[model samples]
Target: MIIDITCRTDRFNLSAVGPHFINDCCFGEDFSRWLVGALRRTGVDASVIGMEDFGWSNQATLDGTTYLVCVAGNSDALADNPDRGEWHVMLERKRSLMQRLTGEGKTSATDPLVRRIARVLMEAGLVEVGVEA
Candidate 1:
């Protein structure tokens, strides 16, 4: 299965604080390390994708399946707006083997693996939304 994960934070803006604060925040170095570790524990080979305009991500693969886990600050401002808080996290599974086996259909957030990943993110205090099929 291919998992595409997007974590949106509430009132958090990594870009405004600059890279220096990355290691000092929850959605920073610690989160990245923790996520990669979690994936590894699940028997998935994972690696960091480094920083992005808003946050960062990690990539993983298991049984020839790919997983892209991303966390970013959401805002509509042309520039980084730490003041514009985020409200949700979105996770979608793409090119999934499960979908193929079950035939093309609506995405189900109740999938075991999806739940597992959601649990992991929740453990970090994120509010999950739009994860349901």
Candidate 2:
């Protein structure tokens, strides 16, 4: 199955930090790096893509299965101003039996790394989609 994990940020001041600074120096870079490393440790191939406006995507492959992870902000907000927006962390699983049965699908939530990531995002004040805050 293909899993997509997306992380969205709460509204913040991008003007003070700048998109590049935030992307590289703040949460975005660290989270993406940690995620990729954690997945690799699990024997999965993973990578980060499109690092701009503190929004990016990650790709992972394991056991012939592919997953896409994304960390982005609302398009309208990003287009207008980097700040004054919320971030989204979307986890999407493709072609999975769970998805076939449930429209939303499932992920490696049981995995320690996955859970840790979720918790960290939550601590950072980001909400998980489909999950009660």
* Steric collisions counted per model: 0, 10
Give per-residue CA lDDT, model 2, range 1-133, as digits (tens). 3333344543434334444553532334445666677667657678876465545667766556455666555433455665544454444444566667775544554533345445555655655533322
Give the range where candidate 2 is weakest over 10 consecutive residues by summed lDDT: 1-10
Residues 1-133 of candidate 1: C-alpha lDDT, one tens digit per residue: 3334445553444444554544433344445666678767877687787765446666766556465666544454435455444433233345667867877633355555566666666666765433533
Tell me, by lDDT, which candidate is best: 1
State each model's C-alpha RMSD to the native: 6.8, 7.7
Clashing pairs in 2: 4-91, 4-92, 6-89, 6-90, 7-88, 7-89, 8-87, 8-88, 8-89, 9-87
List the candidate 1 regions with Cα displacement exceeding 4 Å: 1-27, 73-113, 122-133
Pairs of residues clashing in candidate 1: none
Question: How many backbone overlaps does candidate 2 show?
Answer: 10
Question: lDDT values of the candidates?
Answer: 0.54, 0.52
Kindly provide the TM-score of model 2 when superposed on the true structure, using C-alpha atoms: 0.43
